[model samples]
Target: MESSPLSALEQRLISHLQVLYPQTDAGELARQCLSALKLDAKTPSPQPHRNIWDQRDIMLITYGDTLRWDDHPPLETLHGFVKTRLSDAISVVHLLPFFPYSSDDGFSVMDYTTVNPSVGRWRHVSALAQDFKVMGDLVINHCSSRSRWFENYKAGVEPGASYFYEADPNADLSNVVRPRTSPLLREIQTQNGIKHVWCTFSHDQIDLNFENPAVLLEFLSIIYQYLEQGIRWFRLDAVAFLWKTPGTSCINLPNTHEIIRLLRLLIEHKAEDAVIITETNIPNRENLTYFGNANEAHLIYNFSLPPLLINTLVTGSCDHLKNWLMRMPPAQQGTTYLDFVASHDGVGLRPTEGLLTEWELDNLINTMKRFGGKVSSRTLPSGDIKPYEINISLWNALSGSVAKGPDQWQFARFMCAAGIQLALEGVPALYIHSLFGTENDHDRVEHTGQLRSINRHIWNMDDLEHALNTPTHHQKVFEAMVRLLKIRRGQPAFHPNATQYVLHMGDRLFAFWRQSLDRRQSLFAIFNISDEPQSFNLAELNLIATDEWTDLVSGQKHEDLLGKVTLMPYQFLWLANKVGKLSEPN
Candidate 1:
């Protein structure tokens, strides 16, 4: 009998494997990968090039246990909240690592196949998927030191005997780039002898050796299990550090990109609409490489946005923000950006490597420190410490400005940030704490002894519901965000891939124009970044003389293109030519 011809999926798998493991048998590895999928060879593969997202696709980033009730699991409570309060504003729920973990709040995953019982079971995740799109973390870079794989490695077992990246303790690993100050290698006693294994984030998190094909096959199985559990969006956490080399920086390596490509290929083949998002928190230019000609990551975190936007709001100037935005290239056809001002973690400074000056950075850092922010530092090759991220709640971080000190414009400043993010050329994600206008949890930070815990405040369901029902800053911020998000959902010009051009509205005013894909809707989003009121003539927008425009936020008509427009301290306006399809919230 003659051998069968290879399918398109198999051919793509072989190509990726050949690049990832040139010395190994690419064909056999491809067969094992296909076997991990447990799919029949005759199954017809769907074309995966279809657009999987659009303008109304807003995402909520939260821990599964962020909201809790007395007798119910946290995931069920989260599902209830999303169904009742957030169903109209957001379309996706990004559960930040519901898996059991040893440390780092779920990034150090102990088990890849099951949900943590403390949060909820797989049924709750599936339940969330029934009503809204769900996103899950892949945690691809490393595993918990307490994980089964690591234990097996210690016992010299079959699958994990050589599963970890081992390095000589005395080797010149000073060149390795990492985001943590922890020692790069940990001394562990294995079955054979004493070995020094890589530990990228912390000693509790052991880095995996992807050079072993078995390791790759194991994660493939995990991906298949996640897809079965209704997770269509995969966030590859710390993916840039997946591959390591002896003499290099050991980040953003070619083999790492190839592994991502392989994962992308396998995922697309299994589920056509599935998405892959890479969490590469590097400098602006280096972060862009994860796109890999639109074949690697379907979405990349707009890492530079958080630091740059915060600095703009605090320093009362948009020059740096505007310059950075102008330099940013629009994402390709099959890819887009994931934009957010705040998340479960802190506002990273590493992403602002070339965008901000030394003086500006020092000023911003000092301002944040004055506003109850804690600075987290990373180790350098030269044995110096540098600020890596600013750990604080978004609401608190905007409590004051660098020039004016503490002010009463905290609410308005945050709204300005949200409005600008909504109009940017990407899908906007709101952290659960950000939506609630949470302040820094100094108590939690004291309890957990983790800087990130400052922003990861947990809320009791009843107290949270009471707070929203009452008159408070949290209620005010939540209501304003909901109104803005509802309005954003209605606009076609706010599409993730819509045309965006930075407007030169002076340093005090930050402005941008977004046009719908069909060119029917044009929106001019402008914000006053300073604490003082700012005014600009509508003519600066160059509005079409024939088209009537209205301020989507204030509902003000603008027939005269030359009419002047004014924004209050830290206020924002969404002036649009046409209202989109979705109705405004009551």
Candidate 2:
């Protein structure tokens, strides 16, 4: 007798699981996993139903200094801000690392179930989650060494207390080099004196022992609790390092993927709308795998975005941007990439390294050093320097703070970035500060003395008042972002997993189009990244519209004009044809 097709797929899946977890009940687990997948297929995936992510669907990320909720303003105050200011364009909110932690901008979780008092209480968080209909961080990858789990392991408390991944008691610390160069190490003492636990990035952030089923169950329970409170999304922090082996780099291991797949399957089965977003801050190549054929994370952060923004800014070219876009595979049937410019953490150099040549990196370093004031000398091996001034300037530029420059130039850069994010085949994530063109908070850095100190400041009503009345740089940036968001919300082509590609324009410009299969509606986004004005022939667009179309940005209307269109310096236009026409295939 031959096995059925369903049983055959189940058998193959069980065999795959056996290779990773040899001791587990593979057959039973496979049956459960299949059932879960079937259940998920019956339920609707938690995503926006429309083609474009509405401006109101934007996710405003707030961390450290920007945690205005910490001041205990009435919950209605925050709700009103979201409702009135971004009601049309913004939909979700991401509060970064509100859990208690030791260092590295709250990556070290002391307690998974509780929110840090500095931000708010669990009750407040629960209330906010209910009000906003959003979810937040689930730092299951690592925990602070001071956490109760770690302490219980150290004290040898009963009921699987010794489950933590501990270093060999006889291992020599003198020979063991620390993973990071920071001086924040705190050695844990076992029965046989001190033993060095692995703290991959920070000494205080002790990696959890995922090899233990207890740890896995504990995290699952926590997730279920948050789901009860209305958390529809969970950002799995530092997921790459969750599983480890002695010989390998211990990142992106097979077990890690399996665990993520299992967790995703379980969550989708239990709660229909909840999603798991993997925070694998790796290169594009490595980050792609986190999606796991759309079975792992529902979304992964597009780490390549920041560097692309910087590259376009410096070289005034869209070649690298085009290459990156062309290289990205379409999001698997249901999943989407969470794209953004600046995040709550520091701008990473890993993704940009492959995109930039040695000479380009050197030029970038020199430029940063020249512009960077107090923080200019800090350099990386790739020749990129963390010039504080350049960082602040770029932040200001994006936020619309520095307004005296050519409006076309500033607006061009702003619109170009926004176009890429919105037109891309994914959910575009907007950082809260980016909306208002918020600059680096130097005051917060002085207070926290951490690399991401600026991320911690909270928004004050007084500051908003001042910016609105005084017409500061941030005010203009904020207004521009709001306008772009409003326009994007009204469009239909900017939906998740839409077919997109970079247009073959000159190096100084970037262009892409998103269209439906029937060609009833379409969006064309062209950006001029260069400081000097650049032009492109509209004939190259080969759009199928016989009627005139209007430019959303300049409010200018023109006919196809024999297949020719020209763009101004740093300008971007979203031209749409209401006649249900498609562009001629390239």
Candidate 3:
């Protein structure tokens, strides 16, 4: 068989997959997948490719309160804010679901072409896209049942419509599985009344019929319109469920992968600078598929990460996280992974859910219930319930309320989470809220209760500014995040293409080292995830050179050959080797 001329990342992906699934013809399958996409081959190629996204490329998540702030803040004020606070470290800003939509936090698209009036007009969005590196949501997996596309399709509006997926009139929903575990689904009646529309999420969000060539073309046109308007990044939402067939869960389907590859080719041809990011919130194993051949999605969300962060904290161990990283398939050198601790949505329990044994899960559930009817754990168990329960009991005894008090400890915990993520080999995306230590928005519970509750709250600039300027505990956490961002941006070892190796540090701490292929520069990161201090011997690593290295955060330099290094509770260190002469300080 002739070898394929795939990109570096694609080759790495294929090699990793071959090891996992030995019998499958990974390369041939990838080629076939690329060939089946709906893209035009004539599109131009992107230029000025970037290896990693910077801390200045912070993705500020905006919704109700944030949008309101944007409306009130003078353009110059917003611009100045970005320039001063984030310009050097941030490169991109992602606005969440600004399109016209009906439900599920604006996932239901009433119109792909227009922005929701509640946030701003399409022109305002276009202006922002022109002024800044912006990315918008492309919810092609489904549409608002109220949208003209769905309405026209339901009314049988010939070629002008027919853009939705229509099931057999009498198809059963009894066995249909929803994203959530619930069995109740909202069904829409077509004009014939005999045929009903299947909504995977809610009645308002009707699944789009990607099987139709016309539908694909329509969406392609929609994408071009945005590209022309200066939207460089298209976050493909819920792509996993785009294609459905009987006997399958309709996720990560072969056709869906093909569609993504085709779209990548088209984007490359049309808007060369534009990129597609898939919002596949699956396990690490399945998430790699979205980055097909390194040519499909330019970026994939580290969906399993947030839970891993939480698990590491509660377990006081990095075993699960290390295992997950070891299992991650390598991608193209230039390609970047989007790592984050949280986002506009709630924390997902799915990724780490299966990692826990049934007994462990039940114990966690019971602990949450007993503590305050909510899941809460500071670290994972070393042996079993006795040690785990003792840790939680100690936490409860020392801390008055998990929700409040001991703010520094909470901030440290959050920092520990951020440290591991920023050190990982990927483009770290810090959710604006998380940076400022915004906890669960319990007040928005009612809004999230509604079909599209996630989009209900407005952005409060005053509140955000206040939090940023104040001396609150959350503010401290934000400062720590900023420090790490600044450090990561200054170090080349943190680049996306740098080689990564996970170190086994006795479970309590997760340590990793990133070095240039030529060994010109190197960075070693150690994170103490547990509440107690932990020490590890550096001699075991046998790093090429351990001479005098500077602690990026503390400005302290060590030149000792000591075999031991101790990390304080929830502390982290970013040590870079200082060779020859240190250039004039920035």
In terms of lDDT, the best-performing candidate is 1
Q: TM-score of the candidate numbered 3?
A: 0.81
Residue 260 of candidate 1: its Cα lDDT?
A: 91
Error of 2 at 155 (Å): 1.1
Alpha-carbon lDDT, every model: 0.90, 0.64, 0.62
lDDT of 1 by residue, 1-586 (tens): 9989988778878898888788999888889998998865555665544557888899999999999999899999999998899888999899999898999999899999989999999999999998889999989889999998999999999777889999988888888898989889999999888999999899999999999999999998998998888889999999999999988899999999999988887888788889999999999999999999888899999999999999999989999999999999998877899999999999999999988988889999999999999999999877789999999999999998997788899999999999998899999999988889999999999999999999999999999999999999989999999988998999999989989999888999999999998999999999999999899998878899888899899888888889887789998889999987653322
TM-score of 2: 0.83
lDDT of 2: 0.64
User: What ranges in model 2 sit over 4 Å off?
Assistant: 1-20, 24-56, 64-77, 158-160, 168-180, 183-186, 369-412, 563-566, 579-586
Q: What ranges in model 3 sit over 4 Å off?
A: 1-58, 64-67, 70-80, 158-161, 169-177, 181-186, 362-408, 447-459, 543-547, 579-586
- Selected candidate, larger TM-score, 1 vs 3: 1
Score residue 286 of candidate 1 by CA lDDT.
Answer: 93
- Give the range of the ten consecutive residues with the poorest summed lDDT in model 3: 383-392
Candidate ranking (TM-score, best to worst): 1, 2, 3
Candidate 2 displacement at residue 475 in angstroms: 1.7
The sequence of per-residue lDDT tens digits that candidate 3 reaches over residues 88-123 is: 556666777767777766788788777666665656
Model 2, poorest ten-residue lDDT window?
Answer: 577-586
